[model samples]
Target chain A: MTAQPQIELTNIDKHYGSFHALRDINLTIENGQFVALVGPSGCGKSTLLRSLAGLESISGGTMKIAGDVMNGVPPRKRDVAMVFQSYALYPHMSVLDNLTYSLRLKRRPKSEAEAAANEVAATTGLQKLLRRLPRELSGGQRQRVAMGRAIIRHPKAFLFDEPLSNLDAALRVHMRKEIRALHDRLRATSVYVTHDQIEAMTMADHVVVMREGVIEQQGAPLELYDRPANMFVAGFIGSPAMNFVDGTVDGSGTGARLALPDEPSIQIGKRLEPGRKITVGLRPEFLQLASGDEAALHLSVTTVESTGSTTYISSLGEPEIVVVVNGRTDVAAGDKIGLAIAPENVHAFDPETGKAI
Target chain B: MNRVISSFRDGKGFDIALVGAALLFLGIFAGLPLVYNVVMSFQAVDMFSLGTFARPFVGFDNYIAVFSEPIFWPVMRNTVVFVVASIGGQFVIGFGLALFFTLKFPGSTYLRGLFLVSWVMPGLVVGAIWNWILAGDFGVLNFALTGLGIIEDNIFWRSDTAFSLWAVIIANIWLGTSFNMILLSVGLASIPRDLYEAAALDGANGWQRFWTITLPMMRATIGAVISLGLIFTLQQFDLFAAITSGGPANSSNVAQYWAWDFSFRQYDFAKGATISVLMIALVMVASVIYVRSTRHEVRG
Candidate 1:
């Protein structure tokens, strides 16, 4: 992030007649940065990406690319390449033709365009399928061709709109690395849009979590995982989700009393007003098997899923909590187990506002 | 009986039965007329011999007479012009309309549905309406043309030798434009919208996108439309029958009208069948191209 940023969006807003699609979006992407916009469906992430591409117009705001004001400019005038969710490979064109389409439109000589296409094909592993039509190629090959088509252009930015959502799990994992590797080799700025937080966590240098047309927070991947700004983000960023339980501050300011019968009250470092209510948040990965001489919550396990590499245990209680163990466990359904977590691993939130406090 | 019932429920037998029924229908309605026409072209027949199949075999005499007639080459030229002109006019205007309506303005689809009126109306009825529009002295077309200053006088669309053939061509184009527009619209709609978006992001402007994306994707549909247009134009007889009637010394007499004239007006059945058989050969070539183009569709 040296010098000036490559893309700058300021107070962007979009409306479809009476419906507001995007509300006051402000973001900045530095050159050579790979940013992922992660959110649930209908969260305006795709709309924001399309706005950057100029496929959609911003009703009110200033959009800048490489320090040039870009409002009212058509998509063609914007030097950006997008891999559509559908791949959108030209059905009537061979792979080489599809890759060299932009170059040809610029009236580049045949040899030059062919050399460019061939170079991209070599890296994308599309050399063998260069002469094939899109329909004749497999889904993964078409996906590569789509990537190749964008990569060959060397545009100011690369925008990917759920480019890998169509692949199976195994292929999806494989292509994820391929895309990240491609991004590293080519130091162009990229903006990726996806609903999968794991994809954002694994790939992006910076993750922007959006909800209802607003940016909830943006930071490095692990930063988002370790500390979420709000309760919605804490539940969204982690796999298997975080658990919540209601509790009241004990007479002692250092601990909170559980709403259950005959249990040890949870400990917190910060002191709160006695008898104040709070919502407790705990990540599944932080919970462990209870050890002797520690404050622990003993409960009956209702379900155990052993995936060989890790075991997932769900407790049976009024406020059900999940625990992820490192390896295979002997615990089965309806087994009594005690769960323990450190006070530092516990997160407290204002139950009324669902915000971290 | 059990095997028959089971086969009807789920087997190859049911498929064969459906195909057999279609073939039987085609054989009765289409095959019989084509065979009869071919046989009659080789036979010497009169009005009295029309009811019987025992006419004397003539062996190329009817074809020879048809070629040697003074009006034969003119009629052939007229047929070519009619087919070419009517199809060209219909296709260009229709494609323009199709693209225009694809913009999806308010009430556009309903307006397009209204344009289908020309396609659904009987061709003879269309010709009857065009007759009044093309009337010699006070026709609306001539009045509008003169008023626009494109023409200085009221040209006789149905009577004057120079304008009679064009009168039918104009009417025929109007009759066929809507069908072409509707079909081309479907072809335009079938293209995935994201292709254009991708092309736009690839640095292609509107015009370049049209040539690079829209036209190539519409190759199959355009081929089908043009071939179908040729067949429809060749089959166009009502406009000529209603408007010109090949009057003013065979000035507007195309092969189709001449074929009807030789058969019903002059009782020369052999020559009429000879002309129609030649038309069938042309339509067969068009049909082959239509089939090949559809089979080569590049689906996304």
Candidate 2:
């Protein structure tokens, strides 16, 4: 939250032969911000991260780091370090050597490199494992070694390309917490890329949602969740992905009504032109089972999944809703359920263009 | 049980028959000759005394005579020198060439094709070509050297004892380098690009990366190339036969050519088989020791 931008990308364009990999992009990140780039695979998120690290060359436009132009700079000269998705640790070198490789390349004294390596290894909780080679270490240990190498350089920024994609589910959750804590302790400017939206929501100071080489929306995590600019962002940001139902707007002057297919009509807070095609977006968490005598849309339950804390009910109806209910809901497969959603929780978009209305 | 028997009777026998045929072919063409050579090495026979089942029983006498000959020891020494020097020079030069080709350059593909000419030519043709170039009087090399004022007189390259060994060594080196270059080049290409990028960020420059990353990663390739090169170089005969014919006081005579001389030229088959058996034993021992020492370095 400062006036100075730590990293700035202006009108950056990248191409692979005739294929445009990254279109014109302009972004400015402030100092010590943890920014996450989230998108589906082949969406150029990793490519953008590599461009920032100077691991890849941009076909056009300017990339600046801390007020200095970084175009045409080799990665070693860019003063930016990257943690690859594969962790890319040198198999032949021990963890200690891997951490101190850069310092040794700078021709620092052996004692100094070893001391610095020990310090970083201790910080990463790898002090006792310094003598182990990459193949001998577990996946989590190898990932820590990769991070330790990046941290030992004390670079201007850190770039991570899907750093935890190879870990098991439990380890991924643990590493995600560790990364957030490390970022907090060091306050380092970092740009991380992943295809996992949950990671982006939990870890980023700001999340950038991208699709098909374009940014759909970029904002604080809750800001994006509450006010997505487009249907794509609304559907991509939430888990059980925001349920979308095709409908048509009906109603006159001051208020509007959504005429859902084979389901109950819904009232809207905003006015809309009657007979226009539209879609309604609702999050699974916002939809729940209605109590006795409550006005709701009746749906036939198709399946029910219960975790310890919450139960999810999938149903067949006009809008085909998914409902997240509180724990201990008496819902089962092949049962009829009443679904209720508030107006404030409903999002409407133009059905023709998928843009938020 | 009936169903299982029916299934087996339906088709599995054909595959077994095909495999049996392959093994039979290998046994006749490969195994039989090796067995015959082992048995022949123990027989005392000459080319002039060719009679069915009437050869004298030599036991270890042929092997003893092979060790007793003064010429045999010198030829063995020469063979060792030729194999070691040629294979070493080929590996170094070929590896350098492979590394050079890995770099981005203009017209590199075409240049690589041009460099493969020596490897593609048959061994006899290569020997003939080098023989014409290294001839004593009108060889292109001496003519070029004299014309350039590098030498006042034409050097009889293949006629002199000192120069003949070097002449054959140079030809063998040229012939062997291309194989090494192709194998090592394939190895270099197979390494992931991300490893190099990671190494670069870790501060490894060209030389450090080459030693720590490239050399260790290509250990299997290097071992295979070197062992095969040694085996091929030890059996070299065409260059020596075409250029020196193991002459000039027999200074450049190698074990393979000496075996041929004993079997064909001197008509002493028993000593020839003995030399062949000794060469095979030496190669097998060297290969086993090398593989054992380097096995730990290679990843599965």
Candidate 3:
């Protein structure tokens, strides 16, 4: 939201021997922004976070934290605090001692260190449990202690490496809001790494999606959801993933004829060369059950799964397309379903480069 | 019979049987000897009564006489110095080596494995080797020290009263350092690598991290190592026999060697038993410490 960038990464590259772990990464995170780097495992999301934390040396890059170039700076000198995925609390130390470790290491007076620990413990709800060692605490409590340890430092930026990956499902969901709320309250610049796209979509102000050593897309979550720049981004961003069906533009140039499972042609908003090959992207949530003449595609249902709140129906087509319907659906296996989608909802990409058309 | 058979199949009877075997072995080999030693310390026994259990009871005669011996205080002092110096030297050097190898350059693990050679060697063989190394003249240690200009003369490590105790201390440290390094290495390895990362990110400098993170995390391990060191150094006798023989007017003589001399050479059985009782008492405290330390692991 401001002109000044809190963290800037330009032409970042990393190599582990001959393997290029990161390539040509350029990103700017503004002050107080909650940014999430998200991708599947081995996609270098965690590696990028560690590079920002200075845990892993970058092979090549100009990484700036708070406007200072940070190439050869060690982690201790970087002034950034990291919450490890393991929570990595000192097992021998009590929660209070864990929080005060950095302060005490600086040879601060005992009273001053305890006071600082007390303040951070109060915020993290660890005040009552300060005397308990990390082993005595539950998983969630240990995680809070890990964060409290980092928070007391008042760091330049907070780097979180999959901090919620250890928690149970319900707790993970709860901590998502808590972490985002903590970021908002402190207005701290945070770079969160996760493999879960939902966490990125819901918690981050901006989300960067990465694939093997490269950023595929980055923007506001919905901006990415609505206007993904490539086939990979379109398929990766949404739940149930975007369905890609091979299609060719109609002679009229404003429509596409799907090439599978006896489905008819669908309307497109953009003009393209007639009869050009493309990959048509359709989101499951945007599809509707059609009756009279508005049907975009007719699919033979292969499987129907329901969780009382939402139902997912998949077609028994060569390129299987799934539709998510609200509430329970009577749709079952072997049912022929007629589905309709709007023109604007249809995304097309060049089949060769996977680039958006 | 049926219940026992069923219990065996279910693990309960088998567990009891396993424990009973160990207890029986301990009672025969360890418990009987320890109790016999304690009983003998309070009795008067000559060569004629040595084979019999019943001997003339002398109350505290043996303990008092043993304490009153002119060599008693000196031998006790030597034992204390031996244990303290050997343990301290082993631990410091081992810790340094462990931390050094943690940097993990190529072949460091293999090099650490090679250090175990000293530990596995018979103490007599190691002492024999050290005999050559600590020779009064034409010794490697003296050669190195004079070459470094730290000492101008050969210094006669085995003969000189000042350095005679240290001759054994030096060998014991070498014998024990590898074991210490191995255990400390395990402790260091068990500590999660992420804790250091977290500490580094918490603004701890290299020295600060070592002092706070490495030292505190190693508390249980250090306690175990030190207690084991006490037990090992107390048990150290072959090196004394093989090296100085606690010689040159009993200058390097310690309690274990004195116990041996009283029992085998002087044939004063009660005095030997009395000296051994004192050592067992010391080792009991160390055993308690070792058990407690190993049981209470400081890990999440």
Candidate 4:
């Protein structure tokens, strides 16, 4: 039989008075899996991570860690360490002491605790800074201390609550790779929470997207991007979010008619009831400029922005369509251009329910 | 002169004028009195020379007399006990209440505000209120003690020489606890909540969290509170005046109240000034600590 899941929650619920902070959250994390609970603010991603750490008590349902029911276990007893968004290093304690705090609490010998701290500090690249207090260190060093504190415990699972959100942009990218490398080296189960979809996509192996206290979807990072089960997940997963336009199935039953001026229609590549109203989603990167005979839609460019590596071109009228062209583009504003996309790249959702069709 | 006038028009003169006004006020009201008190402490002023500043330079004679008085050692001992016991009791009880209120129970804010009633009421009024509470036969304190079986009879808190100092200390603690609680609450609130969460996840129990997270993080605040508490407790004289009046042969006497008793009641202004000068030294140390801790807070 397969090993028991590292952490399991079934029908977990949380309520703050009348506000449902988390509802029907059922997640199972296996051993050594890095899971990310990602969403916009107020989406209960942090709440779910805190619940796993036992910082928040679930109002309903069972929680298990390593086959043991953790229904009422305190955070200390849960054997999970959390790195907070604020880093939360003990300001009065030196880096070594902060790393050794858990070991000391277990009444370990001073020599043993110091040895353990030294080893962890070496791994976290904090060897030279162990004697310094948190306030005496820079922000990135403090972040390393927070990570080292969690690492020393060799905890059953690691909980990271937006641990890199406080760092500068360059540092955030650097820490993202560093954390993933550290997780791989330790082979530890981790649940990270972040609002930045890019961080979640790059760092976590399994991404759980949430909205309004509900898990919208959870799958491998690419799976969520390739096939978001619904419109919210679709809109949330990609950068420069997916664009939607009102459409209806054309008379051919295999294409959708556009609502934009000039009535440009797209091939849906699947048969559907003719005249059925639907919403169509197109990703900006998938569209390309094409000749008139090969084009599915003709558009007037309203604005063109170049970020050196890629150029973004937007259409001029109702139902604005944007096209991202890799490298430089000769296209200018107010120019009429023909655009094309493969039928498989076009997505259709029911207008009423916003469900993938 | 033109430059000076231009500076005035540019508002620099107004800034200097404001600083000068504050300095002038302090020099006239606080600085001069302090210097005069120090000077009087070193002089041989008696009833005959009370109206003039040109008294004989006694060269520590007033300090010698004040220190060698029969009641001096007992009064000094009582002062130490009063300050220590009042601060200790206020700190422990106030810290407990502050922690309890941080639990954020419904109506906790209003209840904490209600505790400030004891602080806002004049200390004399508090002492008078405690006078009845500590009354020998009909006092509620006696009634509660007897009801709880901690004591079988009333102890005569105000008059009994054995418990008289303690009686005033109890009242003083009650008078000061709310201020301590308000300040400690602010300190507790300033500690980031995430630190506690981090400690908890690091496998620390609640007790460990208090020691490892709460206490260390509150170092500057605790320093500030205790120093302020020392200064305030030493300045406490109203409770003694209204309750014990340093009575029963000075059993409940302290430096501040006894200084007043010597100066105004017994007409020994030199001894009074000598005692106050000593208290000023103690308060100066406390002020140094307060300033340093606050500066550390800013740097942090």
lDDT accuracy of residue A244 in candidate 2 = 85
Q: In candidate 2, which residue pairs get closer than 3 Å at backbone N, Cα or C atoms, i.e. clash?
A: none
Give the runs in model 3 whose Cα sits over 4 Å from its true position. Answer: none
Q: Model 4 residue A278 lDDT?
A: 90
Give the share of true interchain contacts found in each model.
0.94, 0.47, 0.88, 0.76
Error of 1 at A353 (Å): 2.0
Candidate RMSDs in Å, in order, are: 1.4, 4.3, 1.3, 1.8
lDDT of each: 0.91, 0.85, 0.92, 0.91
Ranking by TM-score: 3, 1, 4, 2
lDDT of 3 at A187: 89
True contacts kept of 3: 0.88
lDDT of 4 by residue, A206-237 (tens): 99999999999999999999888888988899
Which of the numbered candidates is closest to the native, going by highest lDDT?
3
- B1-300 in candidate 3: lDDT tens per residue? 998799988868989999999999999999999999999999997888999998999999999999999989999999999999999999999999999999999999999999999999999999999999999787899999999999988888888899899999999999999999999999899888999998888888888888888998898899999999999999999899988999768889999999999999999899999999999999999999889987887886
Compute the DockQ of candidate 2.
0.42
- Model 3 in CAPRI terms: which quality? high
Model 2 misplacement above 4 A: A1-3, A252-256, A271-277, A291-296, A316-319, B1-77, B100-121, B133-157, B160-162, B268-278, B297-300
Residue-level lDDT for B200 in candidate 1:
95
**Which runs in model 1 stand beyond 4 Å of their true positions?**
A259-264, A316-318
lDDT of 4 by residue, B192-262 (tens): 88888888888889999999888877778888889999999999988998899987889999999999988
The clash count for each model shown is 0, 0, 0, 0
Q: Which wins on lDDT, candidate 2 or candidate 4?
A: 4
Ranking of predictions according to DockQ: 1, 3, 4, 2
lDDT string for model 2 (A1-357, tens) is 567799998998999899888888788889999999998999888889988877789999999998899998877777888999989887777889889888888889999999999999888999999998888989999999999999999988999999999999999999999999999999999999999999999999999998877888899999999998899999889888898887666656223344543446666556778877778887999986785557456677898889878888887655567888778677889987776778778888887888899
